[model samples]
Each structure stands twice: as C-alpha cells, then as structure tokens.
Target: MKLITVIFSVFVLSPLTVSAAPQTTSGEIRFIGQIVDSACEVGRAGTLSSSESRQIELKPGLKLDVDTYRNACSHDALPMTMTFEPLKTSTDKGIVTITYL
Candidate 1:
C-alpha cells in the first residue's frame, strides 16, 4: 500500500512540475487590416483584429510610435500602408495593429 501510494503521489506531482515549467511563445505583431485614403496620408484610420492582436503582447494604454509597412494588397501598383500601436504586455510579447492604409 505505501509503495502504491508513493508512486501515485509522485506521478501526480510530476505533472504539476511539468505544467509549471516555464514556457515561451514565439511570433510578432500580426494582423490584417485595410487602408482608406485619409489614413495612409497621415497614418490613421487603421484597425487591427483581435485574433491577430493576440499574437503579440502589449501593455495597457501603451501608445506606440507610428510604423510604415508596404504591401501589395489589391494591385501590385497600389501600395498599402500598415499602421499600429506596439505594446508590451509581457517580457516576450508585443501587440500591434496591421492595416492597409
């Protein structure tokens, strides 16, 4: 009985240790958005999706500097301006809104 109990207890405790093990996530601020005209000119009118937003981490009320990204959305001739706020919610995560502007 004692042997069985010890083995069972160890098995249960083993999972806790494994589950508590430190883990890390990998990825960058990824989101899909569209760009109007006014926003592209001044870097506004940009929106990001929540699902994609979760990919990155950010801090609450963290205002990020404007960033510019070029993408071929509709026609190769037309360029897309991607704007978003980068925030740091964790030590290894960041959140940003990517949109076509």
Candidate 2:
C-alpha cells in the first residue's frame, strides 16, 4: 500500500516540478527599414516584402552594395550620399552621434 502511494505521488509531483521551470518575461523588438537614393526614388521606389526580406541572405564579413538594390536608379544619379550612422569610431568610443535634418 505504501509503495503504491509513493509511486503515485512521484508521478504526480514530477510533472508539477517540471512545469515550474523558469520563464523569461522580456519582450523582443524588430525593426526593418530600407534606404534609397533620390534618383532611385524618382525612377522607382522598390518595395521590400516581408517574404523577400526573409529570403535575403548575407555571408559573414561580406559587404553589400546599395546600388544593387537601386535597380531603377537613373544613370545620372551620381554623387549619392550613403551614411552608415550609429557606428563606433573605435572600441573605446561609444555609438556614433547622429544629427537628424
């Protein structure tokens, strides 16, 4: 009788102990944005769908050209400005300061 009681208690309490595992209460933030030159905007402001965004794959340490995405940009769209901001100047320096226009 005692053996049966111990087995039943073990089975019931095992699940309760497992279910009490710690859970994180924090939330996640996702930001998706794209930049284009004025010429590209004039010719065609391409749309980046969520599915396409997911399909884009970049290899580590590989740099991508913004012109690749600016397919509709005019050939005359020269002297474009591409600013990669919020970049650290050095390991000792913090995030780059940005001044919005």
Candidate 3:
C-alpha cells in the first residue's frame, strides 16, 4: 500500500514540476506600407462628374494619379494631397478608406 501511494504521488507531482520551468520563443513581424499626407478636395480635373457617385473603383495593382484631381484646397483647410498606388502583388479587393483630419 505504501509503495502504491508513493507511485501515485510521483505521477501526480511530476507534471507540475515539469510545467514550472519558464518557456520563451522568438520571431519577427514586418510591416509594409507608407504614411501619406492629408487628402484634398477633388478639383475640376477629376474624372468623375458632379452627378456621379463619389466612389472611385480601380483594378488590383493599378495606380491613380491624385495630382490630376488638382488641389482645390479651401482657405479654411490645410493644403495637402495624396496618390493611390496599389501594391503589384496585393490581392486585397475592397474599399480603401481615406480618412480626413
């Protein structure tokens, strides 16, 4: 009976001792992108007419020249602009958000 008790105690306590040791891991996280300037109003040179929807659609890997939209910055807002250049290998297909601040 004493031998059985000893064996049972060893089995129950062995896992607790093994799990007490500290564990560590290593890896690398890389971010690929760019920080752009604030968006300006689309001017007369913009392709979309006033009656058209505000949304602009583009195929994957295509680039849009925001400069063509011209700078219609108002006196109340800061003068800033941006361009649209999709990554050549990017497969993401959705609405790209343009935040104004």
Per residue, candidate 3 scores C-alpha lDDT tens digits across 40-83 of 53432345454322332344453332332323333344343334
Q: Which candidate ranks first by TM-score, i.e. highest?
A: 1
lDDT scores in order: 0.42, 0.38, 0.46
Ranking by lDDT: 3, 1, 2
lDDT tens digits by residue: candidate 1, 22-45: 645485444446645322222212
lDDT, residue 52, candidate 3: 27
Pairs that collide in candidate 2 are: none
Clashes of each: 9, 0, 0
lDDT of 2 by residue, 1-101 (tens): 99999999999999898767654446654444565443222111234331211111122322223232334333433344333333355543233222223
Alpha-carbon shift of residue 26 in model 2 (angstroms):
16
